[model samples]
Target chain A: MAEEKIRVLIAKPGLDGHDRGAKVVARALRDAGMEVIYTGLRQTPEMIAEAALQEDVDVVGLSILSGAHMALLPKTVQLLREKGLDHVLVVAGGIIPDEDVPKLKEAGIAEVFGPGTSTQTIVEYIRNKVAEIRRSRKNA
Target chain B: MFDKEALEKIKERQEQWEETTLQQWLARLPERDELFRNLSDMPIARLYTPADIPDFDYLEELGFPGEYPFTRGIHATMYRGRLWTMRMFSGYGSAEETNERFKYLLKHGETGLSVAFDTPTLYGYDTDDPMAEGEFGKCGVAVSSLADMEILFDGIPLDKVTTSMTINAPAAILWAMYLVVAEKRGIPWTKIGGTIQNDILKEYIAQKEFVFPPKPSMRLIVDTFEFGAKYVPKWNTISISGYHIREAGATAVQELAFTLYDGFEYVKAGIERGLDVDEFAPRLSFFFNAHNDFFEEIAKFRAARRIWAREMRNRFGAKDPRSWWLRFHTQTAGCTLTAQQPENNIVRVAIQALAAVLGGTQSLHTNSMDEALALPSELAVRIALRTQQIIAHETGVVNTIDPLGGSYYVEYLTRKMEEAAYEYFRKIDAMGGMIAAIEKGFPQKEIADAAYRYQKEIDEKKRIIVGVNEYVSDEPITIPIHKIDPEGERRHRERLARVRRERDNERVRQCLERLRNAAQDERENLMPYILDCVRAYATLGEMMKVLREVFGEYREPIII
Candidate 1:
């Protein structure tokens, strides 16, 4: 039997129209053999969470460059939790300061990637994290 | 450029040098790589000789400065007469805070003003709107109404300085607000000179900041061209831009092609609107990006001038020499800046800014070193401005016009750049111009593919970005980043609320109603109506809402 492909949702969550990073990352994930869905620009947290639920994604990658992550990223995580998708891994990227990375992780982001992060690093992180989550769920 | 006998002899000598002298060196050093490519991934030859540009003519192809085909330059004196305007793109927090920053830039020898509106303002939203949550004053200054505009330009002299506003999507509204500010200051529209980045086609192609769909957007742009030609003769109604396209990961060739093609589209639109080509085309300007590859950037700018001049005179039948001039402003590429070893970006910006000067830009903006992290701190911005000054005053490059005009490689690259851009023009023409190509997701897909390939190259170590992939850094960042005053947003919102409360609501409503009624007529120039709305203190969001109701919003096709 074939292995089950990991499903991921990549979303842009602000008004700033800097989407080069998001589009590149989305294509990278798809090329890595994952089922990737990209939510285009200006998606609110509510819209992102609802898309995450409907798509049944195992991971949600949020890209925000407008310096609104402190307000938008956590709200996206909360909405996902409110929808009872607590097991979904949430990651963030784009122009994020190092100081905000720790706080964002504490706010339920699994990881925060800054500029110049290799797509391979992200692909491997998603693969390992999703596999671990599956193992834990099986044990549960 | 060279006689046939002389060219043959030089070609033979070059071949002999490669076989004997070059072969001996290659046997020892073996070269760095089997292939050498530029930032655009175009291959570079080991050496360029007269054989590369065989058919080059001194007068026909490379005309004198300030003459036809303008390959050397648009002006005869070039930088020897006046240096390129040192315009810095800046804005953050409330109107009051940004106003202070503008004064600081101007005091520090910035020749012109370039306003960078925040994301909400870029999207045509009021500061208090729910859609603007967490976005107020993040990217630039939050200007929701003419009241904010008044404060933003409070003490700045409108007549002395030319301002460039990097606002699109809601560019017309913001421009109206600026004109109203000048009117209240008793300055005539003709005396106030500046540019509105009123290019909307790029919004769909690369920037994606579009509000309405293509047809209405083109109409609005033409409206500005007509209005500005009659009243604000000095104002550049449109700045056809490729900076965002390059930032979105297009190659140097793609940037050159898409930008010039966009210029052609605007000219066509104006002529179709019953305006002569020379009447509005002369006010049209261009904006380009100066990237890491120095020769590639210089070649792109030179080829742009040559192509624009030829096409304007031959294809569009433009009579005035001003219509053929392709005056442009340049900004150093922001995507090339790295978060790691952030100081290295200073060197990168210096090289790029020097390229812009060599390319003969009308104005230039150098990116701050710390921009990869956040908004530019005061220190970083000063360093950026100093980089341009050193290039202008210290370097002797400004002494001569088109110093690199005769180099074999530079001329060859310029010709190749023109050829590649014409190829793209043919393809876009077959696809029925830029709007149709954009709707089909052609340009967007090409940009995405280039972006993905660029990242993969960096990841696979084919490209070595110092301090990123090669010389790694573990040190924590110690540079002071510009932080938005947390109280600035609150104060801005309170000011916006006061403006809404104090302004005459009935007058605002009447103005908006007139605008809505005029928007339905295809013949009516919307700029006058928009000016009335601005005069009445109608908010940016209110004006955009009326247009949205009439024209509807544009939704882009998803392309990954």
Candidate 2:
């Protein structure tokens, strides 16, 4: 297959410093044959968005556990949009509450995977989103 | 308790029974899985018997409560006389908001207050600092100066309550602010009883909240040890913690070994600083995580007491009986709480809290159900506190000291944990102690490997985290999670600005300069200088800035 591996950037966008899930997901994505860039802990939204654009990745995964998701995630999504990287499939994972899932979705995050979500589910979702982005771009 | 001949006869009989009775049962029924194991993948037997721990000596290993090698307990009466302090860790948003929450917890029957500082405070930054942007009051209560500390504890009498500030890196400054607040309240430093989580080694190894280099950080910690021993005698100067290590995904044995090693390192630092082992050793306390593995957690606690007691007495030559005590505060594992089916966390907290209590924790903090989502709402915190209360009052396990002390399985597991810890200790000693081991990423690699294995277990369905991988739920979380106001940052910044404007600038500058001098000096205790800055109403950011200029900021070497 001549298809390039789908690039994904896994970033910790807050001061939570909990990267276990982030690292696990990154490993899973890498094992699933995706190119992944992990920005370490205490990343600001600008740092994440800048890295996402610079890496030119297809998916940006935000891992936050400091209970600052509502404040941080939305800003991250908005920053990505401002950088014209809206097509960068924005996915989030961590200790995100259920009520905030819809809010995160509304903020332009494509999917919010809370705790207990298998990497397979996350991988499948990212593949689907990346495929959708590619198809749309090809049509355009 | 069995005689040697009887023990030999019983072993032979048990072997015969296993070959016949157990084999017959196994032939009829398939075991649930190929192998039974704990979270660490340690092979666990289906049943434990005297054969598992044949040479178990209760008097030698697990002496009575309040005795040497206190595998049973540190307290004589245990919960029969009084329950473990329900010290709920609570804080979020501004100082005023956290103060209200403190009063709320107190009114609801919380015995002690554990202050959870926000990320900014933890990293030694004021709320208004550019580095603190978008992070004010996000994780815990944000207090930048003595003004905020005073407001945070407003109406909460300093002498009446014990507060545990979960602050590292800038522990001295934060603690000094605390002492100055109490002083302003007319309470002497000696009268203040609480703890500062001045455990920086674990910060480098696990939490990653470290500010200064290891040498300077150790110096600052020793300063607190000397000062606490001389001035604030009742205060637990350092809560050598394994809570974060476990939360960072360490197995029970790693948590036990690594935490004890950190404690031993502190004892070494104190001795090297020319302080008597007994003077500060008694004031040294410990904090451990009560994770889900019930029996294993209980075993870990028992092993911890034994290891600490032996090390303190035999190795360190601490003569005071109090110095030999491994008094600890336990918080149920927050990492175990699932955001999915949030209410299930309540049950999980209760079980872990029960384990901590059974393990003889001097104090306990039960994680609220909504913690995975947010800090915790009022209702969630009450339930968490009630979980502890119910375990203490309703559960009759606390009626007797070391209620599970005599269980064959528990004893077996405790011995296993102790042996595992000794193995790690040997490995660490070979690597030139905990600091060198940490520099080489020993504990970090261990925790990462354990975390990876644990995650793999969950992914492969080998390990079942009730609401997580096993009893999966898609139920919408209906529980209210506490959301820090987005405006909290603006308000906090304004308050910090006001503090900076109102405080005497000359005194603040002088105090910071003095602190800088002391931080640069190998001989001077930095606590007094830090306290002077706190008295001058210097902000945490400013004081930390001076020290950062003097001691240099620490950049953690990346671990692959």
Candidate 3:
């Protein structure tokens, strides 16, 4: 039997006010045959996690151009975990410094894609990560 | 400069030359791509000459500087008379810390002040608010009430310094705080010279910092227009900004077309409110991006001035030449600054700043090199300021007036840009003005498409951003990201709490209630009421909350 399509919720968590990357990445993921839901700009971390839980998505991709990732992103991941969504695959993409990538990954993000990370790279990562999550769940 | 017969002869020769010389050159070189487009993705010609502009009437099309069309510049002498204001956007941490940064820039010969508010202030929330958790002093300074604004300009004289606040969603509230500051200094509103980045239209289009819905948000803008015309004559009530639009991944033509359309829509709204064109148009300034392409950027500025002047004079029927002027501030494109090899961005910034000066920007802000890593450090900010000073002092380009004005390439691109903008105008008009089109998600879709295409180009390596997509580096980033001490938020909360505790509670309540009533009335001008709120030391978040209750918050229509 064929597998079900992956669902991803993309959100802009905080007041960065730059949404070009968010919209582009959302479209790229949507075009890749994933069911993508994009919440518009100025979303709080709680809003993102609640949407993620409500939508029951396999992935939560955050796009922030503002340098508030250190504070805002962790809050988002923590909220998701608090809601018992630790099994969800999470990723971040924007103008994050290389140093911050480790910290974000440590904060439960699966991957951090900086500027110039190709859409295809992201699509494949999500597909692979979702497949891994489903396989692990089946084994458990 | 070319007559009809001369132009015709040149055209015939150009046709023959294209058929022969161009064909041979293309067969050998094959050109980069058949598209051959600019950053805005507008097609470019192989070669431009007199033949391209057949009826090129110099007097009518390209007028003298500070003249009717003002195609060359708004000032006759251009930079020779006075250099563009070397203003840098500065803010971080708490109000006191940002104030120190402000003083540092002023001490280093920065000509003007451009305030950058933190996300909470921008979104009209107080620092201590639950919604503002974990987001204090990250991007810019935190100003919750009049007390913070007071501390922000503690040593800086309100009358002497012209501060440009980069607050939009709550611009009226912030501007009122400035007005109250000036009033405290015993200065009349007429004496103050500054700008409120009160351009809500662009917020809906690009910035995404808008609060209320379109109709009420526009009413707030028109209120400022009416209020500024009467009291704050020297102030630029609205800086119709395209910097964010370009930064949002719009092409140069898209930026020009959309920004100008936003400006025109503001004019139409003002006129609909029974205000005369000449009364407020003179004070309507513009803000544009100085992107990487030097020539294209210059052409965009030149084309913008011409379009605005013609529209004001011919379409709006303004008798005052001042009404036709399109004075603008140019900021080096922040998106163009590469995170990899941050030092190389200095060169990029110098080139972009030169383009802005050459294009005759009235004011300029050069982005700091380390901005890609974080908000600029003190050392990085100094280097950025010196970059502008060196251009003004050492570079002799400013000595000449519009040095690139008459170049065949520049003129052709200027004409092409103007035509593209007009085409967009027609589309927008058919869409029943900017607001209607916005609701229908026209401009938003266009910006998204352009952004995607540009990013795709960069990813595919078709477009080369020096340090980003090419000449890659693996060096460790040593640049210091501006650290906001966690104590800043605690202190910010304490100060906001103190302001709430100390201020006259009854007066604040009365002022807020009045504002709420005025907001409900469609005909009421909100500026005065907002000023009353400010004078009573009401917080930005409080006022925004009242307006939200009355006007309702804006939820952007999904474009993708």
Candidate 4:
């Protein structure tokens, strides 16, 4: 039997309509052989969390370019945890400042990707992090 | 353009020169083994000669500027008489904040005003709405009602300087509020000139800011056309834009083709509305992107004018010469800016802005260098404004009109661009027009595929973006980021609340009722009703809610 695919959900969680980055990343992840589901434009944090739960995604990627990440990203992380998805590796991208990265990670985001990040870097990070999470969950 | 005997002699001499001189140089120093591709990924030839366009008809294809088939330019004088409008697309925080920014830009030699509304305003939401959480004044100014609109334009002369608002979806509502402002100031609607980016078709295709479905959206756009033609004659009703389409990762050819087709659809819709094409077509303007490729962008602009003029005169049967002019504004590509070496973007923007000038743009906006990191700070935006100033005053490019018009390479590239765009036109025409094509996700899918291909090229080293994929840098960004005063959002919410409370709720209710009823009827022009709603101080959200109930919202088909 083939190993289970790393299930991921790519979401755009704000009123920002700049989705060139989001769509490019989604296609890259799908091509990387992960099971990807895209939540179309203008998704709220609640909508994203609901999709995360229903889709049973192992990872959640949030993209925002409207400079609302300080308020939206943390709320998304809280919603995911409230839904008992603490194990889902939450990552964010799109115009987030470098100063906000530590704060976002402290708020339970696994990583924060800035502009010009390579898809291969993202693919490798997801593969390694998901394997580590699975091993920990199995041991637990 | 050449005599037959002369052409034969030149061709024979060129073959001999290539055989002997070119071959000798190539044997000693081989050419680089790499394909030279433009932003559109089209192959660029190493050399071009008259042989490339052997049947070139100078009068037929590129007539004198300000004449028929305006491939060279729209105006005879061009930049010699007046400079292109240096309009900066700006807005941030509250109305007060953006108003200050506008005054700043005007004082610093910005010729015109361009308003960039926040996400909420673009979506027709009030600042206090829950859906607007974390989004207040982030991307642009937050305008919830006429009170906000008043504050945004306070103390600005309405007659002297023209303004351009980058608002859609609720463009009619915002436009009504603007007209009311001018009316309060006792300025005639005909005297106040501006442009509302009322291109909703592009919203569905690339921008994703569309509210209502296509049919109702097209109806709303036609309503603006009818009203604008009658009242605000100087105002541009629709700015058919390719800027966002190119920014969303389309080739220069795709941007040119899709934008012209959208313009054609609007003409058809206006004619179907029983209005004469000449009455509304003249007011239709275009917006394009000046990307990294210099010659390709210049060729795209020239080809756009030729195709639009031919279509408006022949295909649409317009008698007026004004209707045939493809007047346009251009903005340097925002997607080309990088976060790694922020300062280098100034150089990139300078090159792009020069292309817009050479391409004969009516108005231009140069992106700030620090935009890839955040909204431009005061220092960064000044540098951006000065870039245009340098091009206009310092550089002697404005002294000549279409200086590159006769270059062998430029003419060949312009002809190729026209052919490629017509090819796309044939495909879109067969899909039963843009609306049917958009419903099938035709343009959206095309843009997505192009975007992915571009990214892959950069990732795999096939394309080189300095400071992104090549010439890597590890230095930390030290530029001062533009931070919105957090108090602005609170202040705006309070202002919105006061506007709602102080206004006569009874009158607001009645106006919205009439607007809702008018919106349900397809034949009714909703601009008059929307103007009434604005007069009663009905907030943007309140008015858009009625339309949302009447026409319903549009949900885009998932394409990625």
What is the iRMS for every candidate structure? 0.7, 1.9, 1.6, 0.6
Task: Compute the lDDT for candidate 2.
Answer: 0.89
Flag the better candidate by DockQ, 3 or 4. Answer: 4
Model 3 per-residue lDDT at B74: 95
In candidate 1 chain B, what residue range of length 10 has the lowest lDDT sum? B38-47
Candidate 4 root-mean-square deviation in Å? 1.0
Candidate 4 chain A vs. true chain A: TM-score?
0.98
Q: For all the predictions, what are the DockQ values?
A: 0.86, 0.52, 0.62, 0.85
How well does chain A score by TM in each candidate?
0.98, 0.97, 0.97, 0.98
State the lDDT at B238 in candidate 4: 90
lDDT of 2 at B178: 88
lDDT of 1 by residue, B197-309 (tens): 98998899899899999999999999999999999999999999999999999999999999999999999999999999999998999999999899999999999999999
True contacts kept of each: 0.79, 0.47, 0.49, 0.74
lDDT of 3 by residue, B46-77 (tens): 77898777667789878899897888999988
lDDT digits (tens) for residues B1-560 of candidate 2? 65688788888998899899989999999799888888656899888877777788879988899899889999888888888888999888988888999999999999999999998899988876776766778788998888888889999988989999999899988889988888887899888899999999999888888888899999999999999999999999999999999988899999999999999999999999999999999999999999988999999999999999999999999999999999999999988988778898999999999999989999999999988777789999999998988887787898899989889999999999999999999999999999899989899889878887788788888778887877776677788867766676677778888988998999988888888888777999998899999998889989989988988877765553
Q: Candidate 4's residue-wise lDDT over B465-544, tens digit each?
A: 99999999899888899888889988998998898899999999999999999988888999999999998999999999
